[model samples]
Target: MLQPVPFPIRKECPPGACICERERLLDDPQGDTRILRLTSEEEKRLVARIDSISTYADLQHIEERMREQLGIDLRISPGMHEVRTVRGFNIQIVERPGLCRKTRQSIPAAIRRCLDKNPDIAYAILNAHDLLRDD
Candidate 1:
């Protein structure tokens, strides 16, 4: 089953300074990204697609694809137990019973660069909870 995640929309920014389209919320001034915990069904769906990955090269290809397609620099650590941003901000994706939450207010430099270059990509990742929400 897909659980509902609350997305509180903010709408209080000065004219020409609105971040609603950039962060999908007018209140997030620090650009913290939300982490969505995948449900069992969602996890299964993802695992099924990448289960055949048997080498580091395969994983790297997927990572490159994600960067190209989503504009988010995702890196799976060498330890293979953690995922992080290019600047090393840990990104944890957990199963049910673990609630989805936001990252720390400190935006990593890699993400900051992406935001500077293209706010749209930052917006897509920042408000991923809403875009990927099941319902």
Candidate 2:
């Protein structure tokens, strides 16, 4: 994963957006992490699947499946747990803001590399996903 230092959260970040970006660096000063947005299909499926996840084991299973199928990791962020809802819980997935040069360049390369390797996947990572800002 191409991880970058945690840039401060922006005012625009939704009220309950994840703080994992902040905590990750504290846990491992040298750890590199990449934040990726879910594809529309992935997002839809996640909304449906989340309702079924009632336990840690269930969540792990879904996370693994997401990784295998979407090439993204699903982590439980602090914001996710803190959010309140009447019917269901809230989940936020945000990319680190103010990505450095290396991190910014890597995103396009990663997107292209995935496209080149898989002819079956037919979406433009650069265009299809909201990569830069959470808005």
Task: Give per-residue CA lDDT, model 2, range 40-95, as digits (tens).
Answer: 34444554565434444554576577556434443332222332221122122224
What is the C-alpha local distance difference test score of candidate 2?
A: 0.37
Candidate of highest TM-score: 2
TM-scores for all candidates? 0.28, 0.29
Candidate 2's error at 19, in angstroms?
20
Q: For each of the candidates, give the backbone clash count.
A: 0, 1
Q: State each model's CA lDDT, in order.
A: 0.35, 0.37
Model 1, 23-125: lDDT tens digits are 3322344433222323334434434434444443554575575445323355322223332333332332222112222211112332344334554443344
Could you tell me how far off, in angstroms, the CA of residue 75 lies in candidate 1 after the best superposition?
1.7
Q: List candidate 1 segments past 4 Å from native.
A: 1-45, 78-135
Candidate 1 versus truth, CA RMSD in Å, comes to 17.4
Q: Show where candidate 2 strays beyond 4 Å.
A: 1-42, 77-135
